[model samples]
Target: MAKTLNPSFSALYSYRIGSYYFHSNNRLFKFLGSRMRMKLIFKMNCDISFLAKIGDRLRLPHPLGVVIGAGVEIGNNVIIFQNVTLGSDGKKGKEKSYPKVGDNVIIYADSIILGNVKIGDNSVVGAKTFVTIDVPPNSLVIGNPCKIIIKN
Candidate 1:
């Protein structure tokens, strides 16, 4: 959205605004976002649900492969890189609960924050990390099985 001139900030702006409307249970807003959602998804290579409660200034520097679930709750000032998946397990029909991300967290590229997990505030999740458990606040986590390397 930011990289183009023809379809510029207006599209991205509309998407964010539309997302707000969709989150507020307004059909018009849903329609607006639905119209631009796929476009932006294709543009940025990401899928962020309108139902996902995102706080102020959620930054996506690189948006590719980001799959945020409907039930996910993101905190303020969170910086997420590419390939971050905040979602649930493969359970159909039943109500699924996504992750609850804390404030000031930095989730690096290719990190999977999945399935009812809570990423604590001020935490930093390293690249290619696969997280399936709750993370403590002010911690630095890395690795596939996931290791808590440092806790500030």
Candidate 2:
């Protein structure tokens, strides 16, 4: 009783001749699917690096011009707009710090979320706002210092 290989895996692993073309085709299809899914997911996770960790529930209106730094932790149902930067504050020895965002967070266009700050759940950061500090849950923040504009 010998174990049999799966057809797709066997086809992918067996021959080197047709396998190249076959795998290429498969990879092309996979890439296309990932791209389309990325677009859709971006509508929901704007930052690719962030999506890499959180698994694409975060939507980005436009992924372009978005830079999500390493060590950033994003929660579920997050929506980010275009031209957003989520990164470290680059303060004295703060280059390694990353922002931790909570669930249902909505960050608008051109907003910068930086430092070792934690944005609470259901919070919204308005466009062009710069946040360098922590935000409470269910708060709407705007402006340079990111004062809480409203609480939900």
Candidate 3:
């Protein structure tokens, strides 16, 4: 079977357009002329930062303060709340791993998901929860050492 193309490629394309516009202009005033354009630039920066793994269905309530690490494979329909970090654990390079987030997952606010963990599809992670293990599909995890409170 042929490999599927990324759906967010169009968004990345538009981001590149903004990047080109920002770099092409010589005058500073003309560049930052309008407030809408400035906001567009900021959004473009966030989009381009994690251009590799961000899926088409990825929705950010507040794009700012959201950091997505490189090589992280995010599935479609994933909603990430603000102040969320999805990246490596930085364990002295003991093992190189990236979080593989499954489709239709909802990650709540201020949650820290570390290590090379696998979060299954349709799972909901509560706010302020710290997940370090593989969560089964359709499960709900909450608290410091995230546990399976509900199984679907």
Which candidate achieves the best TM-score against the true structure?
1
Score every model by TM-score: 0.84, 0.64, 0.68
lDDT of 3 at 73: 81
Instruction: Please state the error at residue 73 of candidate 1 in Å.
Output: 0.4
* Residue 54 lDDT in candidate 3: 56
Top lDDT prediction, candidate number: 1
The Cα local distance difference test for each model comes to 0.81, 0.67, 0.69
Worst 10 residues of 3 by lDDT: 1-10
What's the ranking of the predictions by TM-score, best on top? 1, 3, 2
Question: What residue pairs are clashing in model 2?
Answer: 42-60, 44-58, 44-59, 44-60, 45-58, 45-59, 45-60
Q: TM-score of the candidate numbered 1? A: 0.84
The per-candidate count of clashes, in order, stands at 0, 7, 0
Q: Give the TM-score of candidate 3.
A: 0.68
Please give the ranking of all candidate structures by lDDT, highest first, separated by commas.
1, 3, 2
Tens-digit lDDT track of model 3 for 84-147? 7887888884875678899999999888888789999999999999989998999999999787
